[model samples]
Target: MALEYSDNMPHDEDDASDASSDVTELDANDFPDHFSEREGRLFHSHGSLPYPLPVDSPEQARLNNLHRILRDIVELHYLGPVAEVLCDVRGRQKRVLDLCTGTGSWPMDMARLFPGVKIYGLDIVPIATRRPERHVQFEIHDVTRRSRWNDGAMDFVHARSIDLAVTDYPKLLQEAARLLRPGGLFFSGEIGRYVDFAHGFSSDPAHQAPRAQRFFQVVNHSLQLRHLAPIADKIPSFIQLSRQFTVPTIQTFHIPIGDWHPNTVMRRIGKMYLNALKDFAESLKPMLRETGMTQHDIDNYVNGFIHDIEHVRGLVGVYHTAWARKL
Candidate 1:
């Protein structure tokens, strides 16, 4: 089934306002200041790449929403209604692990959808809310290190948007393979890179409005400096090279980065993406500064990027999902 979009649908401003207003302030007593000593923009306690983002209320809200948006895009375009196929294949008493599970929304939702499955969500920090679901558990663990789970303990090992967290992509895959039972599935989804805009306004890529090229250039540079894998573009090949898994299959989806699409669903998704990107760029300020990008220059780039996204059309980002079974 193809995903459909409608342009003439009614706008739900009330829902938008509710979502915007629902952000809860992080209580210091409850959340504890885990990042009190971090001087950089990225979280560094994990001894990995400095996670270039704050875990404050607003940032948490943005991440939660981005998680939902990405999940919707993947489910609609890639997995569709067949996410439960893994559950059926592995039987009802399934164990699932989600690495880099920011906000833990995906695993929680999966736990609800597959009530018989036990889902474990791991990340560098515990950002997931306490949910009533008994089968879903969230843990604070880094994916680059050895996991506490025993060998062949998982039925499905899932990862998403972990490009920034991993220093060794192949090693992480090896760990995942070790954790999965034979014939178990390993699935990953990631954005290949920043959005690529196709607009009629400019012929030069450098001169294009809402130019995000520089933003990503700084990001890539920082990741390279930190010796992190730029997994966005290299994820598929990494999966193919792993001897523990069968040949991987992939699905791709192009998400608009602005309200440029004629279809209402695409436009809505694009607008949400624009907001998410704005927050994402803001989070990169510290890393960009570390790269010696002046605050003035970064500000100019961010402003231009926002302008392009708001006024321009034809901007899109590619998201890819690759999956294979343990041999």
Candidate 2:
């Protein structure tokens, strides 16, 4: 449930074709060299790329304190500690599949927290390293496919922000159910949609949040992928549909990307996100110039909204985390 893994990528055209292919047998040559790089700052492993993005980036490697804090919050809110979650398990060693393990943060943390567990992160890209204390493996496999994972084999199956890789929620859920051992846990955290600024936050003057909000709406509509929806709101219903698993306990919380209130943790996050957006706008200026907006217009639009949020607060995004045991 950390920010890094919770944010789903926009689905690309190539995703469908890639998902349809046999992922397990994919060769290293099929992907970029960096994706299959076996050595780095962290120890290397035979990890594969299961998704469409390059996993090895400076932005990914430099995880900040807030990321760790968010991870801890999700861990506490959902599964508690690894020992406590696994204590009820029937086995001495647990096999876990970290579905869509972006940057491998969750699996890495899991391995560090529970050395006895065998954790494997399956993604479109290799984002993790080998750990000495734990049998952690990173593989590039499209978990969206039906034949991807062994049925009833994993003690725990965890997926976060994997919606971009999966077009069908039911199929993904079914796959999760099938992969888990009897009575094993199925843990998921996802966002259904971005928050509507007008409903959630007051209008901002200096940082044209109003315009940015409108812009985001247009962008959201234009984008082919729409997994950013408020996924937490639907968890209860999704769990009810799973006959193989018991009703899942759901927890939803506002993860403010920047400081919304003057003194709130969200305000800081809001600023960071605002800056990130600004940086993104600058990067895309060349492509967006044809849209008729001047560079200043883009800057004002990006900065105005962020400044307004920092000063006025109120708008916040929701993240969901849930867990259910296989019956």
Candidate 3:
């Protein structure tokens, strides 16, 4: 899928037939192994990821679905002068790192794409695959803390959808700056909490989600309460503020929230995004419970959110991807 895929027929990459987005409905009293049940939802008891979502199989499905959606939107595993940087260099070892690598799918794909490159994926929980390619290393580490990699040791660093776990973008940028060599690139992509009818992302209420603006606000509030960053819209600014990189190139992807789009490919992306939204609403359970929401009321809110967003027309999420070269 490319920028010209607006009216194109849906391909396998853009379709949900892969079943990665087919989240299994769980029984009321069921709990998976090594997972803790909180307010009728499952959660990871491992190192703090500051995530309210379940770390179970279903949650992994949502993550995988989202990965595909974003890739289809951008038409690349990454954005930037990545080709020149990752292009095969004679007699030199190139390295890549993925932070908060849920399922380790990104790095895995990158390894296959660049067989000669060494890739490392770090996450709070173990990656889905116990055994990966020889040059690819998967490890358990909380990205919110410092990484073990030495200074200027990486050729590229990738962080996607980590706002749920990281509170400070500037601090994270500093870490990326430390890890990258001169001319190494840093790439980041994140979704904003606010959805609007127009691409301007206007502050005017008329341009916002017709029936779900309050929902976005409440979600942002909950994230702030946990000292988590809900939006990475200002990451390019943070990168510039750190003075560790050249001017960043920012790319925006208008992800539809429902099957309301006229374009066939966009509508397909919308349906997939809608599925992710439902699961995300479900993932809010544990956090909402901590905020004193009763299980009954929480369930009602989740159901209502799903209904509102599904019917809302022209509701589009703004996703920002920024990439820059280290100074």
Compute the lDDT of residue 151 as modeled in candidate 3: 82
Q: How many residue pairs in model 2 have overlapping backbones? A: 30
Candidate 1 C-alpha lDDT tens digits along 1-327: 101111122333311121111223345553333443344333534444456566555567787878767766765422522364355543335678888877777887777778876777777665676552676666556688887666877778888888777778899999999988888888888886565754443444356643666666667777678776467667778888888888888787777787778878777888898898888878767767778878898898777777766676677777878888889
| Candidate 2 ranges beyond 4 A from true positions | 1-69, 75-85, 88-92, 130-133, 147-149, 196-208, 225-232, 260-311
Candidate 1 achieves a global lDDT of 0.68
lDDT of 3 by residue, 213-281 (tens): 666676778888878756567888888889999999998888988888888988999999999988888
> For this target, which candidate reaches the highest lDDT against the unseen true structure?
3
User: With candidate 1 superimposed using the best TM-score fit, by how many Å does residue 243's alpha carbon deviate from the native?
Assistant: 1.2
Q: How much does candidate 1 score in TM-score?
A: 0.82
User: Positional deviation of 4 in candidate 2, in angstroms?
Assistant: 21
Candidates in order, TM-scores: namely 0.82, 0.66, 0.84
How far residue 115's Cα lies from its native spot in candidate 1, in Å, is 0.3
- The whole-model lDDT of each prediction reads 0.68, 0.53, 0.74
Candidate of highest TM-score: 3
lDDT score at residue 296, model 2, on the 0-100 scale: 81
Between candidates 2 and 3, the lDDT winner: 3
Clashes in model 1: which pairs?
A: 6-264, 42-51
Q: Show the lowest summed lDDT stretch of 10 residues, model 3.
A: 1-10
